[model samples]
Target chain A: MITLTLLLISLLNGGLAALIFFRGLKNKANFFFFLTLVATFFWIFGLGMFRMSSFENGIYWATLFYISASFCITYFLYFALFFDNKNIGKINFLNHLLIHSPNIITIIILLANFHFIKDYSLEPWGKSIKLGPAYFFYVTHIVSYMGYAIFAIIKRFRNVSGIEKTQLKFIVFGTITASIFALAFNLFLPFYTYQFVWIGPYSLIIMVVAITYAITKHHLMGIKTITSEILVGLLLSILFVNIFFNDNNLWFKIIIFLVAILIGYFLIRSVFKEVRQREHIEKLMKMRSEFLDIASHQLKTPISVIMGTASMFREGSIGKLPKEQQKKFVENIYRKSVKLSGIVRDILSASEFDTEKFSLPEGRLEPVDLEKLLIKIKDDSKEEADEKGLELNFIKTRAKISPIISDEFYLTQAIANIVDNAIKYTKAGRIDIMLDEDEKEVIVKVKDTGVGIPNEDKSRMFGKFERARNARDMYTDGSGLGLFISKEIIDAHSEASIKFNSEENKGTEFIITFQT
Target chain B: MAKILLIEDDNDQILLYHTVFKMNGFNIISAIDGKIGLDRAKNEHPDLIILDLNMEEMSGEEVIKRLKKNPETKNIPVIILTNMDKRKFQSQMLELGAEYFWEKTVVMPPDVVKKVRDFLEKNKIK
Candidate 1:
């Protein structure tokens, strides 16, 4: 019965190690944890074999168990150092060698069949071993290493909170309790009472169970899906094994196996689908909160201006003012109100893309004048461009460009967003707008000599509430929804595409192509 | 009349504050951005400074940090007028040694002038 429990613990450790290592292969902490689990499997399995082995084979089994224990403790210490995503300072080769020298010496002594163990005797309850000079060395290594590992975890626990704190609580509790059991039963009791050596390996189950619970319940390493799938696979394999080896009716066994396979298929599919939905919701919630933060700040600026200007007029407290000055302040209030409305329109237009039944109203679509629209956009942006000392140029092609059937309002907003982005980013250089056409396509390009988007920022350029690092540094007031809304508007039109080519510190050019 | 320095990037805001402060019997000094604001704070030595938080070239946070660092400008009281949420930035602005934080959306120009008058009178400034 004890042997069966040992085999079960070994299988659990091996399965969990494989599942986590394969799932989180790139994580440094996961790799160390995998090594620790693998080492524990061998330690527990070797201990079980040592209990069952004959007198002559007893020495060999004892050596295997001791070697595995040495490796297990070493790996556990490394795992603890890296646990909870903790870094232990700069890693020098000499420092690593110094840290690992004790384990290396213990393994070498065991491998040479030298001094760690002098004699072994088997009894009904457990096994006993006589101590050699190196036995004290092994004892000191185990006690100090395990003690330090627990201490490291406690240190980390003090520094971290939230879900990480809870995960560490499980880890620290399991490790401390398991180490206490192993020390009392496997080392101290074995030295004095000459029994319960087998209990050390059994105590490891507490650690494994605790970590497995953390993996499934707390999403440790965020490997919940992998653990669920592996568990399902393990159960299905056991059912199939019973079917093939049992002496039950052949047809009944076959039907039960097929049913199990069907159940496993749906089980695995639901787990994957649920996890993916959860991840997507998490990403969207984060984006929405960020958008709210930026949008509130943007909205308040215009609102404040309008409120202050209106309040000044209503109070009539500033004494007599010239009519021209009053007109200017009123104009300022009017311009700010217009800007506030524009911000509202942009936000609404962007939110439309988030809805399920998003479609442009049929009445809004019409044949838009391509040349006239570009000229108007250029004229409107000229004042802002001139304010920043940038020469805004428009190059009109001599060839007649044909108009496209589209929503003129949305199309103009989209094109103007790109133009506005150019003026906002360009600190010193000029912006050029051009309109050209071939036989089947109308091409409009807006180019600027500004801080260009880098390769790292390119992937998320059109994502909601995202800004390039350089752009955020240059201007703090952008809504970050402009490009996303622009892209969506352009994509809504049939056979239309928007693309950009940019180099950092040189410039960016956005090209919009529409099927003519 | 107490001299008031307005460090604001928005032209409309500068005009509004300038007119209101002038009409309220105070001399107004204006800087369009933080770099110019810091220079004016050093040279003009305005009795009280009204600083806008976000600006091109240099941020108001950097301006206040530099102001506190400089022996000449450290004593001049600064009131942060910004569109940022007061709850989020009030404690931080205080820690940076500003005398007060006023949210632009919440306070009208008249209210601001009144506050400035009260502050100057309480401090017994000319």
Candidate 2:
């Protein structure tokens, strides 16, 4: 029974390691996965020899333990290389030495142990061997091997980013559990043999579980799933484990088996549902990333063309025109320049947001005359408003000059965006810009008599690339980043807020309130 | 005028290239994809091929392979224009007979045009 169990455990370890090796080979040539296979092969060989009923040599067990220790050491080195993202070529010589050096040492040690590890006998469960002082070397080697793996894992954990760190943590935990079980079994085997044999297999199982999860879910080595049948197999294994281990009595085992079948059905169903949800999310994210990449590239071309053409025209490379025509050309250039700048800004902002690196720099907070700034903006918007046949007016209730401490450029840009949106959306009606001052705050309200926002789309109006349903129809050319940027600027100030009031076809009012 | 073949998928990019090349007095033959670009290179026999790495059909690498394979187009120096910053791909392209690999983000369109002109002038292939 003990021999059968050992064989089963060895088979499992060998099978898992082989699968990982093949999977790694399919993806690319990964040294760590290859090392894992080597380690598992040695382990399986050791276990197979140790479980043999006809085996009577103590040197055989010692050799098995030595090989296992050597494998463990190589495993640590491989794992370290993997975590560091170091190329295999960098340490090829050292890796070759380490992998081969043990075999040479083990052979020499076994040859010398001809007289040392002599006594061997068959116990009730299986064959047993009395260990020598040389066996301590094997124990020491295994311990040191585990120590290195732990050290590498801990050292690299602080620096590795994203999913790698999570995967490493899982690996560390699994290895630690396996190591502890091995250590316990090694130490207690002399006192009680069969008691801790199961620990090794159990720990191996944990390692398998952890590695399988990392490979399938985390894409730790980029091993893509080949079939859904594997998932089905895993479900069946779960059912088997539940049925086999959950009950003590035979009749209860049968009852539990039946119940486990039902549970397994639900479990499999839930697993599929979970997989589908995860896949859907992954697909959406992938599409979103692809869309962002393509859209940015696509948008860049036209912006580049406009900017390049404008620069060429401005430089008189396209030939000079009359003064009146020049003025008209400059105006056209200015309009195209603004549009290109806005698109470029949006693209940059979106990239920054994606990378989570966007920040508003601190600016000098000495504000100039508000009235002057408003007049300048109104003059800028006049041509745009005139083109659309919309009246743009700035109404000041109080003429009192109050200077606010804020970044003037951001304030101007924010106000300009609101005004630009008003001009773009309002076709026939007038745009009213009202300034009001209180004891604590200065309020700037830009209200436009245009096609108003729908109630359903109002909530997401400030989101990036989200245009109101009515606004989208009215102004099809807008990039939908203005409101999002406006919101960001407002949030950055921490003392400003934007509120809106609107009705369909009546108008929309964006009230920007800033602390004095 | 130096004959230049521009392999670009984006319509706007192609237009930009055409305008720039026309302004700079280069005879430009453009292709929308790599396969067409290769065909144009074989038929038109351009002095140099300005290849964009990423395209909808037939990548720049595929075009480079084809160019290197065909005796007629093999001598035409290929310049790779790409957004990818991967060193491995760059080395692979270099090994596969790309004369120069320039990142689009790092090198402006005008600079690229200038480089092409310089290559033509240096080779004296006009």
The DockQ leader among the candidates is 1
Interface RMSD of every predicted model, in angstroms: 1.0, 8.5
What candidate 1 gets wrong by more than 4 Å, as runs, is A1-265, A315-327, B56-62, B69-71
Top-scoring candidate (lDDT) = 1
Second chain alone, TM-score for each candidate? 0.97, 0.94
Q: List the residue pairs that clash in candidate 2.
A: none
Candidate 1 lDDT for residue A237: 52
lDDT tens per residue, model 2, A349-371: 66565566334565566665777
Per-residue C-alpha lDDT of model 1 across residues A88-175, encoded as one tens digit per residue: 5556899879878887898788888577777766667666688778888998998998888878777878899898788777767777
Tell me how far the alpha carbon of residue A180 in candidate 1 is from the true structure, in angstroms, after superposition.
Answer: 23
Residue A392 error, candidate 2, Å = 52
All models, DockQ values?
Answer: 0.58, 0.04
Question: Which regions in candidate 2 have their CA more than 4 angstroms from the true location?
Answer: A26-30, A55-65, A85-89, A92-95, A98-100, A112-118, A187-198, A216-516, B1-126
TM-score of 1: 0.66
Question: What is the Cα-based lDDT of residue B111 in candidate 1?
Answer: 95
TM-score of each: 0.66, 0.39
